[model samples]
Target: MKKLVYSILPVDGYYTFSQRFLELLKSAVSETFDLSAVIAPLESVFLRFETAYKRERKSEYTAKLAAADEARDRAYLALRHYLVACSYASVEGYKAAADTLLSILKRLGWSMQLASYQTESSRLGNLIAELGQEENAALLTTVQGTAWLERLMTAADAFEAIFQQKLTAEAADTNTSAYRLRKVLQEQIEMSLSWLEVQQKFNPSDKLTTLIGQVDELIAHTMTTARANATRKSAEEEALEEE
Candidate 1:
């Protein structure tokens, strides 16, 4: 019979950093658990608080309290569901919940941008921690943590619309073709960088950055080749005319 021994050793003085990093991840998981276990069951208490506050008012208190209580309950339910949705085991489940929450917020005329920002921030934080783990890295590589990425891409598409609008306005303001072209190119480059930054924040992988650099080099090379071909064609045409 052979005896097996399992040993754990610290790697490169990163033991403390690794432990703290894992703690941060565990803390986020703990928050989800706390919210589901503790905060979720307090919806009734929130409604009761709303009712009590409404009672302090003297004018049409009954209807007012009823409306207030209803709104409070709705908000409470939304928050609970949002948390539950975020804790879902799959990205599809999470997105379904997020979509419902977004619809509710939109109907209430709330700021969609704020909701998107918070959702992206939380998802990105958790995703970064998850990707740090060896087992989860492959599982989550293609999974989107939130709808914020889609929102960002949609916004990027809108940049084209904005550029067109600005170009039209600029045309009306001045007829400088050179200025318009330069402005459009500058704006397009800025928008592209902005989109790239958003993608990098969500998944900060060196491989992705390297891929982008490679693509850029390929584009530059293609442009150089095209320019050379054009110059050669012009020289050939001039020689033919001389002959």
Candidate 2:
């Protein structure tokens, strides 16, 4: 598959946040992986897996560690993309994306914990529980400002579809589209979530139910786009290597 690259510009006041996030990702990666030796492998994986990525028959932690690195890279790339899209996002959409992204960072294991909130938007906790997700997995509260965030969360579900499945180093296969679309969703969700966070800080009046509805729409759009662009590029390359 083609490598995933997100461009988020035109978003005022978000550059610093995006840059800091990238720096944090870099630091976290450096602390975890041997860059010199692993950078190429990591890059290769990124180029191949962009979105339709899957874990090997490896241990969970090993898979999670590698996935974490890729997830971080994907998130960084997405922030840049959101900055660009920020200029056009509707008031509600912008807020939704911002909240979703912030919560996503925490959900992806990037942040250790969610801080308590004290504001009109603080009712977020209630909305999140409405989804009936797993414990501690509720990355953000379910408040009014979470509409964008909810949509972004749906995008994350698409991403998980890709990361958990495996691809072959062989000719095109039936699962290729499924894998790639998942990756695309992964990238899109990460960026959208961050955007939502920024939006919430500025406009806490957005409703949680509204954001959840928006998220469903966004997820559907993302899935369609990713599937249309499916090329089975990675599978072909893997097939060549096996020869």
Candidate 3:
């Protein structure tokens, strides 16, 4: 299997779903991107441990730290990868490498989805305003009710998954899409808050909560749909193998 190994910088709560999805992604990529894991930083606490240990008598912990650094270095060099640094400590000369790694993530379909939501919505709203005055806005709003809405929603789902992990670097979303979309929606919600209040549609808190709820529902539905699709694909592949 072609492997795409991740030596994620450890942050509290980040590894859980990423580790799992790495496996699933590998399966999907088949000969393209095999997934593997090494010790990622458990948290920013790693820096403290490294500093303290370096100050004290060198011990196994120090060795482990060194190995982690080395393994982290080797892992990045080994394949297409993404590194999320939780600490501000520079990797010295590796800044270029880090940027390159991030670019690889972009190529691998890991991008912040928040930009699209704003750009698309604004363009859509403008288009509606141009088409007519009264009914055009309503029609544009109703476009969300159509069949292809699900596909865009699925893309949003993918955004959330990437954003969750990529956003905070710790205790974050395992699904990258979930992370990305939540970030985008949060931005949108913030932008719309004053308008919502002015229009008396909802209080700021209520609007915030509503947007959060929508994101949550989108994530849930996306996960269910992705799982069903995976199951169906596996079944079909197995049948083909048997034939």
Candidate 4:
């Protein structure tokens, strides 16, 4: 019975709202009542919207990125510890070999992983280049650490590739795509309801009443969610300002 408050619904909340609406009308929809054609096209858009949603959220894409970064960090730590642990090696030149590499690492002051994605990538690249220099290459060879260097390089490169993928996905207008799709669904739902309302006036039925009631429930839930999100965002902003 109630109309959708489209603007109040957040971008992330729009897909599920339309989805629930679709399930409600699936049995009763027709060319007369829902002439706005809300089902077939909506199903198609859902696929794209789902992908955009994943890209926009910190779920699948972000999880993979995080996993890659963790792997690289582990590789880096392994290499670092190997060099440091060799400082007291029983072999004569092992300590000297480690000292050569440790001097390079000591200049870093802090782990590059503590930096931002791009910053860490750049620093790690630079560190790898410095370690691969002709003179340092001999020291790496002496300590049997060329394999360690290769592992770090492999891990860092993999992380950078995933980071670049995340960047590309972000640059591909995923947010805008999601917003545009949500708006289309919202408009179609409202238009479909208008036609259904007119049909109900000419030919009253309990079916229409039940369908309207379900839609009203969805609207109520969506409104409550929007209001809660707004309140949370406001509180967060206030906290940041106080800080």
The candidate, 2 or 4, that scores higher on TM-score is: 4
Positional deviation of residue 33's Cα in model 2 after best superposition, in angstroms? 43
The sequence of per-residue lDDT tens digits that candidate 1 reaches over residues 1-243 is 111110111111112222232233234334222223222323333333334333333324334433433333333333334434454546654555445443443454332211222232343334334334554333223334333333333443343344455456545743333222333333333343454456558866565365445435543544454445545644553444345
TM-score of 3: 0.19
TM-score of each: 0.21, 0.19, 0.19, 0.49
Model 4, residue 108: C-alpha shift (Å): 2.7
The clash count for each model shown is 0, 37, 22, 0
RMSD of 2: 22.3
lDDT values, one for every candidate: 0.37, 0.36, 0.33, 0.71
Q: In candidate 4, what are the lDDT values of residues 202-238, reduced to their tens digit?
A: 9777777777778789878877887787566445534
Point to the candidate with the largest TM-score.
Answer: 4
Cα RMSD of all models vs. native, in order, equals 31.4, 22.3, 26.8, 15.5
lDDT of 1: 0.37
- Cα lDDT of model 2 by residue, 1-243, tens digit: 112223211111122223333333344343433223323333333444433333322324335534543343343334323423443456545545445544544454331111111110122333334333543233223223334444534434433444444232322354343233434434543654554455456754335224434544544544444434322422443344345
Off by over 4 Å in 1: 1-182, 190-204
Better candidate number, 2 or 3, judged by lDDT? 2
Query: Lowest-scoring 10 consecutive residues by lDDT in candidate 4?
Result: 233-242
